[model samples]
Target: MKCVVSGGNIKILARAIQMLSKIGEEMFVQPQEDSLSFRSVNGSNSSFADITFHENYFSYYAYEDLDESDSLKCKILIRSALTVFKIPSLINKQIETCHIQLDANSTNLCFILKYKNNIIKTHLLPILDCETIRANYKKEGTVNHLCIQPRVLNDVVQNFQQNLLEITIEVLKDKILLRNYIDETSNLSNETRTQLVFGMGEFDEYKINSNTTITFCLKELRAILHFAEILAQPIHIHFDCAGRPIVFICKTLGVESNLVLATLNPDDDLGSQSTTHTRPNSVLKNSAKKPTKAKGKIKSLSKTVFGKLANKYPTNTNTEKIESSDKISNASETSSPNNNNKFNATNSPRVNSAKVIASNSNTNKRENDNSSKQNAFSSLLKRKSNQEIHSPDGGDKDDLVQNSPPKQPSKKAKLIFKKCFQTTFNPESLPGYNNIEVEDSGESD
Candidate 1:
C-alpha cells in the first residue's frame, strides 16, 4: 500500500532520533527516497514499496528488498524521529501511546500506524497487517498519508520556545521566594530611618546593599535584590534595632548611606561626653554614692560640749560658774543687822506722826478720789449738756413730761369766770369808740 509523510527534514529527523536515543530508544536510518517506484524483492516473494514524502524534500520508502529485520529497524527509526521532532505538537495533542506494524511479501510491503485511545505508543515495526493493508489498497491506492508543513513545524518550535519562557518566569519567581525565605530566617528586626547618638565619632552600621567588600550568600543577595526590585527605593541601615549611633559622622549632617565600615572603638572619646561641662570621673563617682555632710563630726562635737556648759549656768554662760554657798553668803551680807538698825533709827516716827501721815495720806487719797469722782460726774454732765445743746426744739416738751408733776383740772376756773362776768353781751357801741373816731377826724381836718 502507498503512504505519504510530508514536511520532515532529514537533518531535523536525525537530530530527533539522536535525542530519542538519550531517552532510551534504539533507531536505525534508511536511505533517502528518489524518483524510483520501488518494489519489494524478497528471495522468493515480491511486494510493492510503501513510499512517502514530507513537505521538505523528505521521503520514506520501505520495501522487501531488505530483510524483515532491516524493515522493522527502518520503521523504528522513522517513528522515533517523528516523536522527537513533534514533541511539542504531541504534548499539545495529548497523545501518549503509538504502535507501528509492517508486512512484506515478495511483491509488496505493507505498514500500519495505529493509535491506541488517541495515545502515541512505542514498538519495533514490520509486523504484518494483511487484512488492513488489503482494505486500504482496495479503497484508495494509498493508506494513512500524514503531512507536515513548514508552518506547522514552526508552530511546534514556537510552542517549545514559549514553554521555555514560562520556565524562566517560574525560576525568577522561585528566586523571589528564596529571597523572602532568607529574610525571614535572618530574624533581623526592622531598621528605622533615623539614628540617635550620645557621643561623637563615626558610626558603625551594616551595609545592606552597597558594600562591595561584604560578600553575601545566595540567600542574602537574593533578598537584597528582591528588596530593591519590589520597593524601588533605597533602604537605610542603622547600628542596631535601637538605631543609636556608635559614633557621630563628622561630615554632612543627616546624609545616610548604606556603606559601612568598622565599629567605633570605645576609647575614641571625641569629647561629646563633655557637653555638660562636667568632669566625667567626678560625675560618675558622685552618681555612684549617697551624699553626706562634710562637717557632720565638727557640728556634733560643738553641740555636745557647748550645750552642756550653757545648761549649767542660769544665763547660759559658757565661761563663768558660781557655787550655791557663795551666792547665799553675798545675799546675807547685803541684809546685815547694822544696816537695818541705821535704817530704822533714821526713819523713827514723831508724836502723832502716824496720824498726821495717815491723815495727809487719807486727805490726799480723798482729794484724789473726789477729783476722780468729780471728773466722772463732769464727764456724765458734759454728756447730758451735749445732748441738751444738740437736741431739737421739741426736746423741752419731752423734758417737761419727764420732770413736771401731772395736775388735775380745777372746778374753781368755772366759778371764777361766773363771778367776774357781769353779763355775756356783745358791745355793739362803745362810749369812746365813736368819739375817738370823730376827734381823730376833726384833728385831721
Candidate 2:
C-alpha cells in the first residue's frame, strides 16, 4: 500500500519500528504449514480477519493476510504512532468503531468514535495522510507502507499547514496585547480624556480642542504605531475632550472593546480645583508698617513728657526736704491742701522785727518753741496719769494716752477743773451752797 505520513507521525513510526526489531524471533515467528493445518490456522486467520476488519477496511486488509511477525509489526507501528499523537488506538480497533467526518469543502474533519452508549465527534484538521490510507496502500503495495498514510495525502497536508499559520498569528496578537497591558507606565489621571492626552504628551501626541476632545493627528498616529511596534504589544487608545467621552480607536484592530469611556464629573472637577486662599507676605508687610509708625509716635510723646517733668523737678535742687516738712505740718492741721494753704497765708507775725530784732526774735522763737514743746509733753504725761486713775475703761485710756504726745499745762488744767466741777455740784450740793450764801449776805446787810 502507498502511504504518506506527517512529519510528527513519521517520527513516531520510526521509533516503533526500532522497538519491534529488538524483540526475539520466537515470539513473532510464523507457524509451519503442517502445524498450521492441525491448529486450524485458516480458522484463526478468518477469526482475526472478522475481528480486525470490522472497523476500517484499510486496517483489515492490511493485517488479514500478514504472518504472525508482520501482524505484530503492523500493530506495534500503529500503536506507537497513535500513542505519540495522543490518540487512543485500543478503542478504535473495533469494527466500524471510528470514522472521519469531513465537511463538503474537506477543510475540517471530525473523528467519530463510540464510547458506552454515546457517539463522540472530535474536530480535527484533515491534513494528515493517514486519513487516505486506501490510496497509499494501492500505490505502495507493501503492508509496511500502510503503517502511516497508505497513499498520497497532499490535500489534507496543505490544509493543515495553512491552518497552523492562522492560529499562530492569532496567538501572537493576543500575547502582544497582554504585554502592552502589563508594561504600561503612563499614570494618566482620570480627568477628561482631553486632559489626559495633554498630560501624557511624552507618551502620546494629540491635538486638544476647546470642547476638550482630543483628536490624534496623522503624526500622532504614526508615533503610536511606532510605539506599538517597539513594545510589540497592543494597547487600548481612548480620546476625551473637555468633559465628554468619545469613541476610542484601537490601533491593531479598528474595533473597540466593550469598555465605557471616562467622563469628567462637574462637581468633582470643581471641587478638585478649589483651594483655600493664602494671604501674601505683602499683607503682613502692610500690617507691620502700621505698628512701627504707632511705636515711633508713642516713643516721641513719652520722651517729650519725661523731659518736661525732669526740668520742672530738677534733681540738682535741695528744696525737696524743706517743702516736704512744710507740707507735712500743714496737712496735719487741715482737712485738705487748699485749707492748709489758706491757714498759713492768713497767719501774721505779732510784731515786725527789722534786722537786729529779726535775728534775735528768730533765736528767741526757736528757744521758746522748744521749751513749750517739752512742757506740753510733761503736762500731757501728767494728764494721762490722772485720767488712767479716774476713767472706768482705764486700760484702753492708758493705751491711747501712751500713743499720744503730751498736751500743754493750760489744756490739762482746764480738763481737770471741768471734771472736778461736774462731780462736786449736784442738786443737793447746790441747796447747801445757796444757804451758806444767804447767811453770809444777812450778816453783810
Candidate 3:
C-alpha cells in the first residue's frame, strides 16, 4: 500500500505526532481511501490521542486493498516518527512531498521524502505489531461542556506553578477557575497556591449542568494546548467529574482534521472538593498575584510557515528507477535526479546535497560506500530538519529526542546539516539533481 503526503499535510501530521508523542511511545497507523489516522495511548492509559488527515490533505492519494488485507495497519515507535518530522521548517520550505509505502512482505516501513531540488531521500522505519487505542467514554453522562479559545486556556494554564502536578478546573455559572490542584496529601499554603479566573467572555460557552470541578495533569494539558495553539483553534472540552477521563476536541474550520485527546481524571479522592457554589469569593487566598496571563515565547521551526508554498516532485521515473531492497541490492544509479511528483522546488534555494551527506556520515572515510552518499543525504535530511526545532512548550528540544539529548552531530555534520537548513529562496530548480555525479569512495561498497 502507498500514500502520499504533501509538505503542508506533513506539517499537520508532524504537529499531531508531536502532541501525541507527549503521551505515548507507540503510534498506530490506519490508512483508508478517504483519510489516514494516527493514534496513541499513554502507558498508564491515562491519556489517548487520535489525529486524522483526509484525502485532500495530500496532493496525491492512492490506496489498494487486497481481500486478505482490507486496510493498512502498522505501529511504529513514536520516537522514530518524531525524529523524522522534527523540523516543520524543512517540510514547509525544503521538502515537497512525503511518500509512505507499506509492503506486507517486508518488515521495514518506507518513507520517500521528495524535496524542492528534485532530490529524494528514502527512510526505512522499523515497526511494531498492529495496535489501536480505543476510547470507551460515555457521552450522555458528561455534565460539563466548555468551549474556550486555545490561547485563553493556554494563558490560564501558563500561570500555574511549574512544580504543581495538576490544575483544578471549576465550571460555574459565570466563569471558569483554574487553580493549583490541592489533594488530601497536598498543602493549603497560601504561598504555594495559584489561581486564575476567566469570565464567560473568555470562552465561547461554559455550560454546566452542575457546578462541577475536576483536576487534570498540568503538563499534559499544556501539551494539548500547544496543539490547539498551533492550529489556532477553539478547544471543546467534555467531562463528567474526576473519575472518568476528560475529552478535548479541537478542529480547524478550514482544515481537514478530527483531533481528539483524552486524559483520565485523578482518583475520586480529589473529586470531593469544596463545591464552587459554597466556596467563598475565591478558591485560593494566595499572596501571589492572581495568576497573570502571560504569553510565553514560542520557538520557531524554520520561520517557514507550514502550507502549500511550492510545487511537487516525484520519486523516480522509468529511466532512474529506485530499486527496492529485495532486488538488485548492489546496483547504483548514475547520480541522476528523477522528477515525477506534483510539487517542485523550482523557487527554493539549492544546496550541495552530496557534500551535506558526507558530513552527516558516521562511517569512516575509508569505508564510504556508494550508498554512503545516499545515507548521508537521507540522514542529513532528518538531522538538519531537527535543528533549532522547539518542543510544544516553547522549550528547545534536543536534536532528535523528546526528553534526552541526541549525540551532537560532528562539527562537519552540523555544517552539513546547516547548509541545507539555513537557506532562504527566490526558488530555483536543481537542474542536475537527478543525474548526480558521485565521487568514488569503499568498505561498505
lDDT values, one for every candidate: 0.23, 0.23, 0.53
| Candidate 1 structure quality by residue, lDDT tens digits, 1-445 | 2232322222322233333233222232222222111111111111111122222332333333343422322223334344434453343234322212234432222222233355443433432222110000111111111112223222222332221211000011111000110111121223111111111112122222211111011222122222222222333322211001111111112111111111111111110111122232434323211111111221222233223322322122112221222232244334544322221221221121122110011112222334467664565566455532222222222111121122337667876676446575434454564454434345555
lDDT of 2 by residue, 1-445 (tens): 1112222222222322222222211111111111110000011010000001111222211222223321221111222223332432333332123333323323333334434446553435332221110000011111111111101112122222221111000011111100011001222122111111112212232232222211111222222222233223343333332122222122222111111121221211110111111232333323322222222222222233223322322221112221221233344343434322221211122111111110111212222334468664565566455543222232222112111123356986797667556756465654465565334346555
State the lDDT at 20 in candidate 2. Answer: 23
- List runs of model 1 lying over 4 Å from the truth: 1-9, 26-56, 59-445
Estimate TM-scores for all models.
0.13, 0.15, 0.57
Candidate 2: worst-modelled 10 consecutive residues by lDDT: 37-46
Better of 1 and 2 by TM-score: 2
Better of 2 and 3 by TM-score: 3
Best by lDDT: 3
Per-residue CA lDDT of model 3 for 87-143, tens digit only, reads 876687888888988776556678888889999988887877643433333333468
Question: Model 3, stretches more than 4 Å misplaced?
Answer: 138-141, 183-191, 253-445
